[model samples]
Target: MASTICYCLWFSYVTILHLVSSLAKSDNYIIHMDLSAMPKPFTNYHSWYLSTLSSALDNTDLDTNNLNSASSRLIYTYTNVMNGFSASLSLAELEALKSSAGYISSMPDLPIKLDTTHSPQFLGLNHRTGAWPAAKFGQDVIIGVVDTGLWPESKSFKDDGMTEIPSRWKGQCVNSIGFNSSLCNKKLIGARFFNKGYRAENPNITIVNSARDDTDGHGTHTSSTAAGSRVDGVSFFGYAPGSATGVAPRARVAMYKAVWYDHAVASDVIAAIDSAISDGVDVLSLSLGYDNVPLYEDPVALATFAAMEKGIFVSTSAGNDGPDKPLHNGTPWVTTVAAGTLDRELRGTLKLGNGVSITGLSVYLGNFSSSHFPITFMGLCNNDTELTTKAKGKIVVCENFIYSSILIQEAEAVGAVFISNDSDSSFGHMFPSIIIDSMNGDIVKAYIKKNSDSTASMSFKTTALGTKPAPSVDSYSSRGPSKTCPFVLKPDITAPGTLILAAWPEKLQVDVDNYGNVTLFNSFNIVSGTSMACPHIAGVGALLKGARPDWSPAAIRSAIMTTSDIFDNTGRFIKDVGEGYKRATPLALGAGHVNPNRALFPGLVYDAGVQDYVNLLCALNFTQKNITAITRFSSFNCSSPSLDLNYPSFIAYFHANDSSSRRVQEFQRTVTNVGVGQTTYVARVTPIKGFRVSVIPNKLVFKEKNEKLSYKLRIEDARMTRENEVAFGYLTWRDMKHVVRSPIVATTLKLES
Candidate 1:
């Protein structure tokens, strides 16, 4: 009885704490402010618990003290705004709200909960590391996925959390909706064509009823990788698993169909960007760009620049033409994400020479199943670098790293029976690829070297295989240092952009799958790409922006870059990304993979703001020649280049002078956080074993909450004037009297003369 009473008291206390917000939503949908405390919203997760807050509003048994002490409580509500809306933001309302007493103090950064899993056409790459560290819950930052309209009811994409379509996108009424095919009916969604950038009053576009409709299904998959909620054990594939979710999930999404009928033009893309900005989206992730495309001088390039100027962080695909000439859209300006393979083993095995002799492991070259032909294991190649040999009537087992397509054409054509590929990135091991049981290739080599003769006499065995069924980075997604524009490192970074599943048309699924015997959890799929990673980054951006509402775009980027994880599975620095020649190999991380928690407390950040971008565009002179690019859906505005995409502070940077090439100059970001209370703390710098960090001032102080502090960090060493190098280092503090902490860097720098 005592225990029961205590439980009841606890329940009452928890419920009472949310009393204020309880009154706002009669439904049990409650929202907690603390990033750590917030629970994921489920189609069925909050149905019952929500009553506690709402019940009090009706009755008067609520305890005011509990409500007062609760950090923050908000009624969760979603409204469809696809079609045009009559509501207007009055200037008076804005002024009054800004003037409101507690407004400034209470404001937080915008959220980054993008819906990455909207399409089903991803490669299902499961990249779940080197991302922001939170409870792993999705965030609530709004993203404008200007692609196909979302069909919330499809069985393949049933679990999508879309509440309703937007009002502004209430396209021409349609009758049917679908998922598999392009257009099932018109009334289901609101789709308006904003394509074919022309010099006319209205562009050649049409409006049709749709449910976030998609034709190619690419956009749908991309969006899913960004924000699809967890349904199965963890995630479909992309990063942000467990308690750590996408940057935003509770945030709104504005979907636009840009590449309808498998076509995309500068006008269409520009219109989409303009439309997104007008809709007030926080970030824009577009995984589309072309080679030999125009520069900031071109409409497409200029459009991208404009978006950045508006304080919006634009993430584009680095382009697919890798290991080839004329780079893809791997420009340094955009947050271009590239693809890399993940494996458990450093070496693999192949059957060369005889019909039945298992000598040792070789690198994977493709075939794994149905080995009807004779096979033998070859010995380990050196350093697991390159493998060579002659296999006539036998099979060759190659480690992943080498695209099977090449081996398929070469070996098979020369009388080789079959091939085996070893890769382990969850689902990325499709086709002939084999998984290398958690052990690395080095281990396999060591084992072979230890038992050289025994293995040489052994025959091929299927038992010595590995598998993980999760997706991995696609070899064909795209590469950076864009061929067309090598000066700019095409893809700035990589994120989860692959085979993803999101909200699909309800009418498309025959019978959606459910968890156990329930109908609550619906919709899910696998995916891959920079598209996937873009939303992941965007979500982290939202979280950090929320924590430090005043940070500029550049600052956010800097936080993500500097504090990113910069090591490979082997704990070594990722190698040169194929193209773009830097006197030195640029770190795989232009800054590094994003670290949201670290970003929240990053001692320094490069601040990119809208004004900074304006200056960049002004000097570069990237202006539009036509006005019809904007949608009729929005009230058009024409002004100087100052009003382009609110470029974040970081996007404002330009190459230093005296060089024809637009090379980036050196810059640094410094931060000091109160990891503790009032007095000062000791500072230290211990970089990752293989990396180095240069800390300026070397030591600093951290104040308590409600108190602000500052520090001075030098850019380069006083002894030498390095022309174009960023001064990198770590800043640490321990046993401080006040809040003090150094940030997390992915690597330790090796001193070089």
Candidate 2:
């Protein structure tokens, strides 16, 4: 009887707890307000927000004078990015906010994911001459890195040769439990963090303090890649051993910690960006993004637009969801970069008993016996029970790469082999392992089938440089044909993002040898992703900014895009590693792989200002109110609407089965001469089979530098026979020393009439 009574009380307590949880169902929402509509009597926007929140609660007795009273609900008050605040609101509270004055729009705070590095010599950067000396190796330029914070003690952040901090810098190193202001120096100028939105979303998470120190190696790697100091004799477990330096070694770095762990709240990211803008960073590098959303709705897009208007160049990653559509960061103002393979490879070889040698990729530093071991195939190795039974005392061959290296070790396997199509095989396994392509994997499988006993031996990792057909589009790098705005080609350029060695947190272990011992070089790590590609562009942009301080953000982007390389080091068209090694199109490579040296002196640039982007939004049917919400403009007229954005590339869309005899589209563009002296540029168009492209007046003659000229391109598609087909070509404007090229993409669609 006593036990029954106790059980009844326990049940009643759980029932009451459930009721309270249901009553307090709330979510975080970012609320945008009209700064122009604020009451005249209120001078502080925070006070106004407090009163608004109190009014929304219908609490007449609450004190609006005390700002800290609303700290539990108020997540962040954004000032620079937008006139807004993020708060934890319930369904009924959100409805009340909608009816409140000055309220414009509200969106639920979403989650964003974090998306690295290489030798400067691979991109033709020389220390004594060329871009390095011309740009002073990006001295005194500030690059704001927004990601998972950074490791302040890394050798790549040493300021031994750095000059004094730039006078324009106004940022500070926020003090927390583990990090302090004194940790910052001349090289790493500032550090800050935003976690209010994160804490609000995860109410149960215990945050010690708001510290901007990198725990995950991503932020440190990316920050170091953009503008890290030079470190001699750096390597990742004895692979790629040599001196390591970022693209721009002397550029000052500032850390804005927005992400926590593997993901970040959009509201926090916006807050970080807002602070960066006010802090006067010359360039913003964000290696994080979310799913493709409308420009007006995406907080990162809105914040980046504000940054662009402030003359800050923003470089973002083209995501890692590759060989797929609808990648993020499609905004024209931001330079979206994609991942590509470097000329370097960490190579390993597998020798089968049948006298067949297959070359593959691996970062394993372990050694195996020269004697061959019996190998058996275990499809995928996802099931522990199956692996335990079939994988004991033998080398296991799996059909795909799995993240759980512990499973293979626990199954008592001598070694493991993965057959994967991914171009990035930089993962260093805890055991002896190597990843081979599917075609070579089939050969091993056939060898096993033909012989009763299949034996194989693997070699240790070795550094190999100057691999042919490099700068190929990586298989994991996101592809384009921007879903939101296809007129502007996405993935503005490509850079080295595969098997890159960059600085890492020393406490982290990324590689292990055969004996399950951590590798020695913990200060650097090998990683790959478009996250790595974005900073390469950021570093290059800093170089350009330092060389040409008068150039606008648009001009810098135009130079990078217009002067990129369409061919590989071998003088062949760049190929897409994801598409069965086919020739990459504009949709895959944008203008092409970034040629930093060539970009330094692009003869002509297609420039666009804020008004041009506004015109683009107008062409896309954005309302005046929507424009105000995004741009913070009080009054403006959508007087001109045109799809022609004066971009560096041209894309014309057509219907696959339009019965009309002729389908013609025209685009107008203006180019400004940026070369040394007066010169004339002649236009040349590469012919496409199904389309005819003509440039009006076919030549642009500029008498002086900075002179502007206008031209119109007319493309006529006579027969659109294939459905969903794309034709690629180029339009080049050549002078004595510069070849300003633009990719011409003509895509056929099945449009509903």
Candidate 3:
């Protein structure tokens, strides 16, 4: 009964400036044991580049533009001290590699660092929000960050204050690869790896391990956010920072490092997808996506579709695709999210007192008469359109457009009074005087539009006081119903994917008080990104998993979506995809933001399981024909009419279609009574006339949590007509009446005599 919410985040960084992450000692399981009887992990050691270079390079570097490159050459091919060879490499070997390369010098340092100072953002998002009402302090959840590699021993993943990796992760990573008791127990972290294709030479290769040794840092942040147990309450990090941890705290992780590199080749992703299903992960969160070819192109999509068939809920970011040029992956099975900023009690405001005030009214050459003020910036006060003072003895009014520096200098120059501005560039800090939103400015503009006279008085008092960050949609979150795409909805829902405070590398903690600061060195730094928000969904997925281990991925996704809250904390519809624009579609926030509480008991959920998806592919001939693997349940070329997709599906209509199509497919599911509608509703399946489907317990009743219900469906029919097309729509049950649908869940058919 104890479950919590957590998330990873997405972020953009100038890699060049921040890549110099410090190096930490590697945690080598083999370091302590003797290896005298076996060969070293590598022979004639050389990274891929070095090995390739030896075969190509010949002459040493000569004078290139008379540049002194000797010193630079000695530091070539740098690897993080956290890498495999960093600590082991002797100075001689390091120097030799450095001397070998001419153009290249030291290898780029990982752009991560340690900041022990916890950020206020964490409290604002997790602790104060009550988003994780059940999450407790010190309790741990072993959430897996299944991505490319984790480089567990890297500088950023260390335990010391120098960087800020969690002690739980470090403690477990020391002796085992993943899910180990001593190292990976309690609050431990683990990883795995997987490959998509067979070895090219033999066309037969078995991927032994998919342990994460991160080539990218994405996996690191994601895992941390999903189940990072708190160091101390006030220094909280993940949403599930306590005992009744993430959806499933007692749940161990199965990190299947399956990344379909290279813009995503379908066949490859499928392998990982299949592996995850086989691994039986409770919940899967994918912070990746693609643009084209429906949600079925690359293997990731296929595998994701496959995993759903196996009941693995998948979640992903809505892509950074924005208003102008958008792209996203919005499959019904996947839950997407768009970003939204938080607006707290504190907001940025500007006020000007005696130090700043408007003297009087005057029209500049720019607006009143473009001729004299064709020049936008200079020549204001005197020659443009100076106005005489009126009543109240207040400062004079003037047109806004004076440069900020000019306004400050002008206010002082015109010792007569102070100044005010309406339209400027940045936020409140753009000018020295008081500032208001353009809407406030429009009030003045609207009055001017009506009267065109300066006699109307608009008085105001200024008292600027507080300054704090409010949550609103981030300016960079992507919008959806992707461009060049019409059917798919994107960014299913958004979470707190921004600069957040969490556990950091312990070594980095030292730098805190070194400069004399309130150093809670026990904690690490603060950060953000969609990568952070991902775990929130993942953790929720885990909670759902704890309830129904056999639920299909689609069902889980449906549970999360159907339960989503259409409103925010203030009871307002969360609008704006992110930044400052509308996405122009419902897909921008598919099912709205996740409502985990509702998800705990969604009234009804759409089902998409691996078997169902695979069967769907078989129906469409998308799956490869497996002669030996084919069973009696499987069918070959069937005669079914080509689909007329002008309807709801997103395929093109064509001739030469199978008129007689019959296949054996199944979708079995169970729904629980989650709402308080105590009335027992009658059961009814619609499209009552088309295709054929039989249900069990035709009518049933439910009362509480430990509810019970059952149903079985078998399809038998063969026809090709408009009726078939209509049936391809969704099948629903309303009170007692209902409708039948195709593409999986309807009683099937084959063109028969």
Per-model TM-score versus the true fold: 0.50, 0.80, 0.46
Each prediction's whole-model lDDT (CA): 0.38, 0.81, 0.37
lDDT of 3 at 42: 28
* Residue lDDT tens for model 3, 1-753: 123222211122334223321111111110111122223442322233333233222232322233222221211221111111111222223333455323133332333222121211322224433234433311232344556544343232223222233343321233334423233333334454545343332245433343443233455445555544333442222211222122333344445455523122344445555555655554566666666554345444555555555455676666654545454555545566654433211111111221111112121101111111001112233432222222122223233434333433333321111233221112212122233333333333333345433222222211111111222344455654443223223455556554443334332331221211234332333344455556667766665665555565556666665555445443455555342333212333444555555565555445533343334434444344331132213453334322111111111111123464433223344554444444354444444334554445555465664363544444434343342232321233233322111122231222211
Give each model's clash number: 196, 2, 100
Candidate 1 residue-wise lDDT at 427: 29
Give one digit per residue, the lDDT tens place, for model 1 in 493-564.
444443333443322331222212322222333334454556666655655554555555565665555554
Q: Which ten residues in a row have the lowest lDDT in candidate 3?
A: 365-374
lDDT of 2 by residue, 647-703 (tens): 999988887777774489899999999996689889999997799999996888888
In candidate 2, what residue range of length 10 has the lowest lDDT sum?
60-69
Q: After superposition, how far is residue 14 of candidate 2 from its true place, in Å?
A: 98
Question: TM-score for model 1?
Answer: 0.50
Error of model 3, residue 400, in angstroms: 17
